[model samples]
Target chain A: MITDRIAVDIKVPNQTRYLCLIGHIGENIARTLRNYSGDREKLAYDLNLVLTEAMANAIQHANEGDPDKEVHIEISIISQRLIIRVFDFGEGFDFKQYVRPGHPLDEHGRGIYLMHSIMDEISYQQTESGHVLKMIKDL
Target chain B: MNLQIEDKGAAVLMAVQEERLDAHNSGELKNHMLKLFEEGKNNLVVDLQAVRFVDSSGLGALVSGFKNASSRNGNLKLSGLQLQVKSMFELTRLHRVFEIYTDSDEALASFQQ
Candidate 1:
């Protein structure tokens, strides 16, 4: 029940160009928490990869590559847990029904799968504003 | 996206000279690979030793290039996958789709076989 904690809050326009910034943010957060628990490089790598995938999904699929739209990112380190929430004002899909088809050559669907693989916990929900993706990792 | 194209006699070794291969620059890689494919250079090997990170968009570019090469009766191979890239391939079971090698030489040698 650790509330009232906000480490980072950012809102970027739904442009692919901003994806790199999100990766850097994730890396910086991991670096800042290097003294706690997990391997620093691995943590940074996972955070960067997961955040990039999540942001890309929001920019490309949720926002539909609309540069005018906005993607909100919230990072919180609550009780030694790193939590990230990405909000998009777009149509949300049924994440439970989606499965990674056995097409190794296919390109698009790997984003969600990678997010799930890297993060400790992942879920999608529809909020009053839009769709929100929540990912958590233990620090 | 930094790329280095080397003519390896029977195969072409295209090494990614960047640290990241994510959505921001994956389109560049895709376009470059397609350009090479259109030039009748189909036997391709993508060296990822220098690439420390690759997101789904990057993976998509490689797959698109693979499909393009396949349509041209040429094959695309992968070599020098760093741990992170290899993990992504394994996570998505893409290791079954692409011909992955330990090194560019091995990948180029496989083109002969």
Candidate 2:
């Protein structure tokens, strides 16, 4: 039994070039946690699903809605709780406006739906700096 | 992603190769599938054996395929889900929404009904 602890924080510019940051965030946060469920496959999938959704969401809904502004992502995990905050450096999004389930035949606007469903709790705070979405998942 | 449609017996099978079927390619894939179904070819099966990663975007593509096929009086099934991709299916519980088989051949044979 090993109780090695770890932590990582990354900053990424909101350029489309940084799209792969989702994969990185998943790897970092998953590594940071010490105590986790023994099911390797389940743990991998759960972490991937949550991180990918959150990262993609941040990329899509950046603060100022600026295509070039950088989005800030800070993630930290302590024991069983994984906390992730994705900040967008663009204009704010109309959270209430895009919450609909959308048309059945469409393939977009489904990110938030999946994210909210998978994470234990997901909340968003929009400030003058940008939009910050914080998510927590209990392992 | 490379998408190929196969007409096997009574089923129309679609093979998706590459990484994503989301915002960038979902529209195109939907258009292609819809066009085929419109041509009276139903009974769709998606072969995802080559796909390693899929996100919400990918899920949306599968869902769109499902709705379109069902709406047209046909059905859609998925086969050959890799470990990582299969996790997405189970995580979303969309696995329950979809008919998954161990392989593409089984998925095709299932359309005999």
Local distance difference test values of all predictions, in order: 0.85, 0.70
Q: Could you tell me which residue pairs clash in candidate 2? A: A14-A70, A63-A88, A63-A89, A63-A90, A63-A91, A64-A90, A64-A91, A65-A90, A65-A91
Candidate with maximal TM-score: 1
DockQ of predicted model 1: 0.77
Clashes of each: 0, 9
* Candidate 2 runs further than 4 Å off: A1-7, A13-19, A28-37, A62-66, A94-110, B19-25, B38-40, B83-87, B90-93
Q: Using alpha carbons, what is the TM-score of model 2?
A: 0.76
What lDDT tens digits, residue by residue, belong to model 2 across residues A34-115?
5666665555555666666666666666543356666666766666577778777666666655444555455566667666
DockQ of 2: 0.38
lDDT of candidate model 2 versus the reference: 0.70
lDDT of 1 by residue, B10-107 (tens): 88899999988999899999998988887889989999999988888898999998889899899899999998779878878889889999999999
Clashing pairs in model 1, backbone N/Cα/C closer than 3 A: none
